[model samples]
Target chain A: MKQRFLKAAAIILWLLIWQILAMIINKELLLPSPYITIKTLISKMSESSFYIALLYSLFRIIIGFLIAVVFAFILGVISGLSKNAEILLSPLITVIRSTPVMSFIILAIIWFSYNLAPLAVNIIMCFPPIYDNVVKGITNTDRKLLDMAKVYDIRPLKIFKGIYLGSVKPFLAAGMNTALGLAFRVAVAAEVLANPKYGIGTKLLQAKYNLETAEVFAWTFMILLLSYLFEYIFKIIIESRRYNAQTRKSDKVI
Target chain B: MLRLENLTKSYNDNYIFKDFSMVIEKNRITCLLGKSGSGKTTLLNVLSSITDEFKVKYSDFEKLRYSYIFQEPRLLEWYTVYKNLQFVLDNTHMSKQAIHEKIMDSLKMVEMEKYADYYPYQLSGGMAQRVSIARAFVKDFDVLLMDEPFKGLDPTQKEDITDRFLKMWRENRKTVIYVTHDLDEALYMAYDIHVLGEHPTKILYTSRNAYKMNDTERENERDKIWQILRSQI
Candidate 1:
């Protein structure tokens, strides 16, 4: 517990250094101090536009993350189940993984509705990571255990419940953690480029054009805060699931 | 009714078995006696029909169910004890009551009943092996294959498990093909013993050893088998 206090002190020291650097620079457009950023954030809290922009983009990004999770899991399962399917899907996943985020965001702007481009970009950003992790998880499942289940004529449902789900959980947790960060970053980029009217990205763009550098810093901090908030909550959910992930009991099916 | 005839296994010009054949008699304990690399595990794998490198042929078997207790426990590290038992139960008709009773019985047989809720990580090497035995016996297979199941056990634990195993087998009646390098173990448990010999393995020696002695006399015979085996192995 004392160790945690030291770590907290270390973080504050770094923040202080940042604040000092910002003050010496004395150019809000270039860098705002933590104080200015926090003040702007507190003032923005009273405005309904802040809530609208925040919730609207949060909702879309979460949807995008969920869609990526579902599709990645399906494609991962397909490839894991068949070597031929992996060979077929390999190039597509590679292309998605290697492509620049900005390129996808720009392409999505022209290809999709203003509201949907963020989802599209976020999905493109997320699927490859989740899919790769899940595939690796499936591949690493114990061969001996599978053989035992096979010889026993264990039902497919029971095999999945007892072996597959438990095997893939760590991978799923890791993938979700990774994809969450990427999804939020890409969604905001997509929103700014596509200029979705009520998104945090649109507010960022408005601040940029108006030279309200403090507001820009505030919005950026809010994005960081928002991402951290969602992750902390979801982490609890994910970790709670992890604690029981190995609590396997077979399904009774003849 | 498991039969292996002229079954051969080779890995990159290294042959473990060459025309090695054995009829694993039904409802009886068969032990294989030999040194390491004597194709003991290879023969067992062939008999189980899961030999990856072996060219196997079986005559008088039709879709036989086989469960194996590996040399290591091979328990899935992420699962609990009861879940591991459930993973291989072939019979779905056992009532919740019957299932619990049998689960308790099997775990009790191995003295692992208390650790039913423990994960594999929490078990000692001996305890894990016991769970593996429970899991293998729990699955109601026609044949139970054990590969050095008593490898790491201390003397008292080994004798205790072997005794409980015999009692259970007498009641359950499984075709158990047990492989052990220890001849003492073979003499004490098996009705028939087939010795797997040098590379390009063939039947070195095969004999029927009837069990007709008192407990102490049987154990004394085990020591003789051990003395003879130590020189040969």
Candidate 2:
């Protein structure tokens, strides 16, 4: 709660600064004040086009992120398990990591629609970090633990759940958290480039041309809120593992 | 039925043991006594199949399951001491109730019933090793292999652990093969001690029914075993 209060205080200070600066400039066309930005944002929120844009943009970017998660996890496990697979796929992962998101977004625009350009960029952005961390995590698991598991000759399912999953949880979750933030940033950047219709990027681009600085700030805040909301929900889900690992005395699984 | 016939094991062309052979009689404690470099740990590893580099002749039955207590406790750090036992028992053919019973029994043996819920990270070096001992005792394997299982322990802890281990061996009657540099440990625990010596390690001596319990004048026995180990070093 104290941390929340501090964050709120910081945002208030920044907004007040923006408002005072806009008053000094004294031109609504150049920079609307905070109240005007809020009014514009509230007015925009009531429009059906705004909701439609939000849904389409959210669906595409989120779908891209989820696909990347699955993609990284599967390949990461394969590379972790075998030397040959690591050698084969490592160059491709290196290439993905080094390539710029803008380059991919532009290439995707030529190959796909506006919706897909951002989606593809999001996918590319999310995969490399996740794959690298998970593979490293699983591979670096203690050899002694692996030996203990082998001596037991446990079932494959149990090996996955008990041994591999336990070893890779922190890495996997951390990668996802990092990738989540990058995904949203890249997704919007790609959107602005592709000029996706009815999206926040479209509004942002319009604000820039019209010189509505406060409206741009409002849209930026909205993007921040949405990204934070997504990350918060995901963090809760991942942290629940510590809870699930616990078993009750009543023989109930947590 | 436990036999290692003409087993040859080496590391980087340095032979740990060559043409070494031993037969462990069923349901008895066989102690391997040696200096630190005399290949006691290596031989134990070979028997437990933890060392795959060794070649053994005339031991066609390598399918026998084994439980090992290493020199290090090697307990999983994330789990409580009791949960470690519970988890190892999770996929066993034994019923849940049987596993719970075994955990309780093993915990009692080492006087670690109070630390059932403490994670391995929280245990001292000695306590962690005791939990490792308890884990092996509860596993219900055909054989138990302990390698310097009492390393870093003081005298009282060693005695308590050795007693608990012997009691476990009695209850389960699994073929127990324990390795240690401690001279009295072999004297205290073994029905037979196979003393190995250096440089292409081989059995220097063998003593059967070496020392009796309650004969606390262990000086002579300790010095004799110590001499053989020192000569190898």
Candidate 3:
């Protein structure tokens, strides 16, 4: 309860700073006050286009993130299990890590349709972290436990599920936690370039063109909220699975 | 019987054992007594085919199943005591009911049946090692390899675990190769004791004590074994 109060206090302090800055600027077109931004956001919620744009942007970004996560996990396992795969894939992963997001967004716009541009950018943005963390997790599994498994001649599937999954889950969760935020940011940037039919990025671009600073802040606020919500949900899922695995104990065998 | 001829194992540039040959008898506890760095675990690793840099001339031994208990308990932390035992049993063709009964029976052997629901971290060092013992026994292997499984216990816990281990071994009669650096431990556990010497890794002494000896006889035997080990040093 005390921690909750401190967190609330910290948020209010930041809002106070923003409010003061907006008052000093004294121009809604240049820097909108927090009140104007919140008012704009609440009014925008009543518009059907707001829901449509929000949902469209949310679906595309989330779908792209999930696809990247799945592919990254499979690639990580392959790279971890075989040296040849690691050698062959290292250069591609390095290039993806080194390249700028804007460069990818430009290339994606040129190479693909507007609908796929954001997804391609999000996938390229999310893959490296997930792949690297998962490979590290797999390669760093306890050798003693593995040796014990081998001595018992445990089946390959059991080894993968029992030992490998137990070891890799934390790294995967961490990677996803970091990648989710980057996915949202990159997807929004790509959508702004591609100017999709209905998306938060499209609204953001329109607001900017019209010099509606309050609308820009409102859309930015929505993106922040969406990113936080997804991260919180992902964290709950990972932690709950870990808790269940740890706390599940049966006195009688099953 | 298990036999290895001309066995050579090395890590990097250092050889722990070279051209080593030994015979392990069937259905008896053979303790390999050696100092800390004298390749006791290396020998067990070789025998279990974990590293696989050896030539074995065994009589149907390679076809038989094997289990290992390491220096630590090595129980999976994610699993409860019951599940740790069940993890190995799941590999077999036994019915689920049979596996449950077997796990219960084996847990009873180590007197850990009441704590079957406890996780590994919830257990004390001694209790965790007992669970590992139960896990090893539940596998129902023809041979069990132990690498100082009771290395860090207090005297009371050590004695209790050793007695419990021997009781389980007596009931199953599996061939066991127990490794230890302590002379008293080897005396307490082994039907045969093989003392290992360093500087090329060969057996310094071999004693066969098939029958239980009284305290006086055991003391005399300890003196004889000590002399042999001391001479090698």
Best by DockQ: 3
Error of 2 at A192 (Å): 1.7
Model 2 C-alpha lDDT per residue in residues A30-62, reported as the tens digit of each score:
778888888888987998977887887787678
The residue pairs in collision within model 3 are none
lDDT tens digits, residues A1-254, model 1? Answer: 99999999998998899899998998988999999999999999999999999998998889999999999998897787788999999999989988888889888988988888888889879898899988988888888778767666689888877787778889988998999988788889888999987899999999999999999999999999889988899899976665354333422111
True contacts kept of each: 0.43, 0.11, 0.43
Taken over the whole model, the C-alpha lDDT of each candidate is 0.81, 0.79, 0.87
2 or 3: which has the higher DockQ? 3
* lDDT of prediction 1: 0.81
Ten-residue stretch with the least lDDT total in model 1 chain B: B53-62
What are the candidates' individual DockQ scores? 0.36, 0.24, 0.45
Judge candidate 2 at residue A67 and give its lDDT.
Answer: 94
Give per-residue lDDT, candidate 3, residue A164: 85
In model 2, pairs of residues that clash are none
- TM-score of predicted chain B versus true chain B for each candidate: 0.85, 0.88, 0.92
